[model samples]
Target: MPDLSSFPRHSWLRALRQGLSSIESQSLGYTSPKGLPDARTAVSDYLRRTRGVLADPQRVVLCSGATQAIALLAHVLRNRSVAMEDPGFWLHRMVFRHHGIEPLPIPVDDDGLDVTALANTTASTVLTTPAHQSPTGIVLSPARRTALLEWARAGNLVIEDDYDAEYRYDRAPVGALHALAPDRVIYLGSVSKTLAPGLRLGWMVLPPDLVRPVVSAKSLADTGSSVMDQLAFAALLRSGDYDRHLRLMRRRYLARRNYLLHALREYLPDATVLGAAAGVHLTVRLPDDCDIEDIVRRAASRRVRIDPLSWCYTEPDCAPPGLILGYANLTESQIDTGVRAIAAAVGHSSQVVPDINGKVAPDSGP
Candidate 1:
């Protein structure tokens, strides 16, 4: 839910119209597997300027979305084990599993993915969300970043997921890990966050060695992505509309994030808030004794949909309980209402809570 409410409808319509008008006759028939040249160039330039990722247009492969980018990698890198953060994105693990590649889980702490632990694993590849780590929102520290790169250079490969790197609040934006060692890092990003997920547009900046195989995989995946959308995106990028949209949404999301934080402080003050400085979602660490399933049921009963952080783990029973609250798509009032509901669900509020979904029984720590 990447703030679709604030999507620039008028600007996109304008750009789309312009893009369609400018589309050459030949472009309508068939396009390169590497994607529309205009879109690729625009994406490369935008990434280089914003994320400090030195990407060449030729090396950029536009895919259906980031999921497809990962799938393409899975297809190309078959028979190899990939290490992912223990409490990382669940879909990454599922996608790898679908491709017969079982991912080794490396525990992540406040410092981001434990690179030292990753070094000890026999896995040669690691997929990481370093910019603002998914769910945890912990930025990879400078020391860990260097160590991770050193590990990557030592006959290892890194898949950098720059998922929600655009919306940072507290600190200066951290440059993409690809910048440190482009040869070892495969950078992945998607318009799914900035634009609409329905558009299903994404790009990957691959290492030179990977350009051909991934492109071949993509060619077999769908021939190519929708050409019309790519053209419109290129136009949006070229006309400065995309940057303007991001800037506008950044301020709006920051406000929504702040409101949620303030509400949480007022209500669920005991719950620890993580990764609130950036990204569309925030992770709330609950007491270890709390039953996450019961809380989720209670939240659902109240019409508030909150995701359980435990789902991201390979073994849910062993993981600490937390909630991944997405604030970008909800209004301030809705956020307040949702937090109040969660507080009530978790017994944080003094109000006599309803017997909703039966009460959550406490558990002694293992």
Candidate 2:
């Protein structure tokens, strides 16, 4: 079994210190249904300056996290079909199921989501990650962006989940979709990826028509997120600590990414690594002979945690076979040892299923 543990970091300590060191703290009480004003204002300013979201403090609905935002939107936009990238974050698909909304698995290529295909569907709402797309790390083509916005203008609600837009290695990250069509795109983001996942802080920039309904859903969900944390986040953002953390994280993840690639080439050269363009995790496709499920089990048995490629799919989708390697939690030494263990566990053996569906010749081309 491969020893594939996650990347490790200490971002939460910084935020915790910041939170604990507040000069005068308020009571831990129910937050405003729309979220604390300062938090919303902070997020609005961050999006404008960082993500280029054309939004006001009034439009930012702070939620428990991006997942909560998805659920809230699913509830508010009932009966309206929602479309998402097929090999997307599986939790998003589950949220739609729980809310009685159909999560249409729209196909994603190297160019990003097939916006034309999404437009051809009967969905009323579309969920997208335009900046450093998840699972496949491909930037959405500019043509697709224009087409999707045009479709949204023609009467489709585009829920933009700017989940992991902060880290970009190749070039400066692209601007937000809401900046171009604020009236049609509902922008969502969270500190889960930036500060830490434990914080559970995320915000949504709802369309004018969605503001009330989304807020109502949020009010019912949990009466809003932690007020203290929200205020603390606002302080962090206003103080420029949040952006500083992002820049710091980008440098760290970039190094980890380089290490993983080097280790793979030196260790598992037969493996194909994709989606290294950006984001916290990269996808590495295994040869067809690899028993993905068995590989996961073996990795776990070896005391390493790895997410299987198939785990992200509810329905069969066009995702190549690979594991989503999150290098945000493990150190380089751990990564090296883990990948070597993975190579050992996988052994020089390919567990190819006896079918042409997923064939991986031991010596294959990229």
Candidate 3:
């Protein structure tokens, strides 16, 4: 067998290393079910300055991770119906199901979720990733944002999954929809995409009505995340180290993104790269003739893993023949090698690579 150890590790390890070196101590005790008070306070300030959302520290509930936050929120809203993006984060839907609330489908275009389609869906809660819609890599349109806020005026709740929210590189950054309407939106963010998913650390800005129940739910779920990790994160945020580390990661991931774009052009023809700005991964859609599953199997055979976009959808029809390549983990050279392997295995080109480099906004192509 060939040596398969040459592959690069995912971004999680790198984040863990950063977290360890920056804040290396383990307090190892159980934290508050409502999360670290100081951490919540700091998060409130951070959101105010970063995303323009004015949040109450007391209203913030910290938990194990974003997924846990979602689960807890679903539990709290069990009586209410749920609405989610059609090609939304599948795991989010799974959590809703586990809690006995099935999210209604909301299809999306390049401009993010279809707010118009949401008219008839009866729900007091709607989950969405607005900063950068997953899979499609599109920002939510301003009109849709307005409409969503309008929907919220009717007492609808928006679970804002700000996953990969800080990684923007292309157009001007999109302000948090939560900021536009805090009471109507429940904001969820974590170190999963930013620092490390393993930390199992995340926070949620709950609606006033749901705060107590959600906190109780969290307490019942796991009591809380690690005290030391939460404290360390608080210290890191206070010390500005988290921002510094994010700056470093931005520079690093941007370079990797460029390399991937180049690979698309050189190694594959009739291919388009999308979702480059502000996230760890980008999706590349191949032409119709390409066998996506075959390409995936081929790439895996070469000892590299690439996620197919179709896996994210709940609907029967897949969007396109594509793969979601997580560039944040791989170095530039590894990206070149991996893309080359994928291209060669998929009957594309081994010799050519894209001289073009960039993140495609919504409407360009999937």
Candidate 4:
């Protein structure tokens, strides 16, 4: 989730007003499940410019959100199980299961999903977050990226969930994986991270072959996404308001992330922070013996909420103890208070090691 309080309400309202004033009455009747033409074109232009996605408006299908896009794909790719990252987004697993498509869990290391493990699976389709792995925040390495695409070229399909790739703080965001193999990769993205989840706006840049079937599934699911909303978004994109809003949010989120990093350094010096270069959240690896459930309870008692990393794993008990903390929605003061509370909860459970300077050392990962 992004900082919902900072949603571009004024810009969106202006777009909506402009869109409503000019929209044809026929457009209000019903729209193609592939989405309105203007909207698709706008999305295509934005993605190509920012993420290096090889998107053609003709191949772009708009849906309510990434959730619906997943559901539509599940429906289209019926009877085929899909490979997923072990510590990936749990909701995606649930959506796949709901459509009776079982998900095969592929292990994720520091370089993102293990493509070798994925290739070993019988599944022909795989869902991945290559730009920034969910929960873990590791980017797919170049070698793994090449391997994944090669696997795709071998009659397999890769679903690239390019979620939250727009918020990199330390450097420019990575290019979408779909850019390398447009025909083999299905790129998924949504406004859930940048603008607001409530907008329920998302897009799929599909392989030419999957477009019609997925669009048919989308039609059966909701006839089509809200046309007015689509037009409003198109207007927003055309007027450059969307890009402006993203620029503002990036600076805001970066400051929040820094504050959280500082808090962690001051309060939990023994913890190791991973994937802090981008995204709204970062992962903190706890000491081996720390009781993560107990930490959760302790933090909750102090009015601080944190997600246990185990919840993202296929087998929760087997996961290493850690916490996934989001600072995007918190103020600096709130972040400090929350970190202090978490530190107090951790107490003496964390085993601290001194560096050469004899000070407790803090560590970070790329």
Candidate 5:
């Protein structure tokens, strides 16, 4: 989730007004299932300029957020199961299952998805977040990136979920894997994290061969996404307001991330933080004796909502005790309060908290 408090309402309104005034009356009717030409072109330009994605407007299919995009792919590629990062986004796995596409869990390590483990899977399609692995927040190492692409070249498809690539604090964002081999990679991205999820705006830059089937699947899904919304987003992209808003939010989120890190050090000194380099949330690895369920329940009692790390895994028992804390939606004081509450919840643990020495400790267990 993004900082909803700082949503560019005025900018969006201006874009909406411009979109309505400039849109053709003919466009109000059923447009192409691929999406409005302007929207697709705008997305293509933005992605090409920022993420190094090899995007063609003709190959870009806009949908109602990444959720719809995933569903469409599952429908088009339902012949076989898809390989997913073991501690990946849980909701995506559910979406695949809903569309009758079983997801094969592939282990993720500090270097990102284990390409070796993935190579062993029978699934032809693998969904990955190379920029910043979901929940874990580790960037895919150069070696792993090459290995994964090699695997894709061997008659496989890579679903690159460019998740949380916009808010990198430590360095410039990594380039999209799609640029290396566009035909073998299906790039997924949305304003859900940057703008707002309610907009339900997302896009897919598909392989030439997959484009027609995906467009067909999208048509069967909803006849295409909302045209007005798409046009509005196009206006935002064209006018440069979207980039300005991102610059502003990046500063804000960076501040919040820093404060959260400080709060963790001060209040929850025993906990180890991971994935703070990018994304709106960070993972805090708790002591071994800390019961994650009990900590989550106790934190909820304090009116602090926190997601246990185990919830992101396909098999909960395999996940280590930790918490996924989001700071994008909370103020500095709220973050401090929330961290204190979580610290209280974790107070029952008797295991020693090792000094992380200003580095994220590597996980020793699966």
Candidate 6:
């Protein structure tokens, strides 16, 4: 979830009001299943200008969210093995499995997804978060980017989930992988991080060849997304309010991230923080001897909610002991308190907390 407190409530209200007022009486009926054309145009322009994605409105397929977008892809590309990052978004794996498309877990490292290892997989369709990998904030290296593109050109499809690419703090913004090989890459993104996940608004900038199939799949899934909602979002994008909201959020999130980093340095001096330069969450690698479940339990007892990094892994046993701490929803003081609680939890673990879907053991407490 994004920071709801920072949402541009007034701007969204203004845009939505204008959108509703501008809806012509004659255009009240159902529109194209591809979603509002104006919305697509707005998104295309925004993506190109900000993320360097080369998209045309004709190729943008609007869906409920990235989840629905991937579901549509699974439906259209059924029976195909979709290679996803091993310790990737677990929800994606479940979505693919539910849709009857088994996802092949590909290993990811400091350089993002191991393109060399991915090349060895029989799966031709690969889903990757190349910009800022989920759970692990590793950006794909330039050389590996080239190799991935080449591989995609060799009759493979790269599904680029450009999620939360707008929140980089320390370095220059990394361009979307779709910009490199638009023809072979399917770019998917949503306003879930920027605006709100409740909106369920997202898009897929598809290859020219995949547009029709995806559009048809979208049509079958739902007649179309809410026309009024699309119109309001289009207004938000065209009026530049969405970009403004991003700017405000970037500053706020950066502060929270810095405070969290400083707190970690002070409280958990032994822990290693990963992916702190970007994204809303940071992964903290704990000492191997520490029981993650026990620590999580202790933190929970102190009213500090921390997610176990092991939950994202397909092979949790093989993954390093760590916690995925999201600072986006917490205040600076809260983050400090949370880190202190976690540090205490780490320091006092005397028994192994049994993994209950990455939850702390019921008996374990502060």
Candidate 1 accuracy as TM-score: 0.94
- Give all candidates' CA lDDT scores: 0.88, 0.76, 0.76, 0.88, 0.90, 0.86
TM-score of 6: 0.94
Residue pairs that clash (backbone atoms under 3 angstroms), model 1: none
**1 or 6: which has the higher TM-score?**
1
Per-candidate Cα RMSD to the true structure, in Å, reads 3.9, 5.5, 7.1, 4.6, 4.8, 4.4
Residue pairs in steric clash, candidate 2?
A: 2-342, 6-330, 7-329, 7-330, 8-329, 8-330, 288-360, 289-351, 289-352
Error of 4 at 122 (Å): 1.0
Model 5 per-residue lDDT tens digits across residues 163-261: 999889999899999999999999999999999999999999999999999998888888989988998899999999999999998899999999999
Q: In candidate 5, which residue pairs clash?
A: none
Runs in model 6 lying further than 4 Å from the true structure: 350-366
- Which scores higher on lDDT, 4 or 5? 5
Q: How far is candidate 3 from the true structure (C-alpha RMSD, Å)?
A: 7.1
lDDT value for model 4:
0.88
- Candidate 6, residue 222: the lDDT equals 89
> In candidate 6, what residue range of length 10 has the lowest lDDT sum?
351-360
Q: Which residue segments of model 5 deviate by more than 4 Å?
A: 349-366
Report the number of the highest-lDDT candidate. 5
**Window of ten residues with lowest summed lDDT in model 5:** 351-360
lDDT string for model 2 (294-363, tens) is 6677677768888877766656444456888877778898787777656654552453221122222352
Evaluation by TM-score, superior candidate among 4 and 5: 5
Tens digit per residue, CA lDDT, model 4, 239-267: 99999998999899999999999888877
**lDDT of model 5 at position 271:** 81
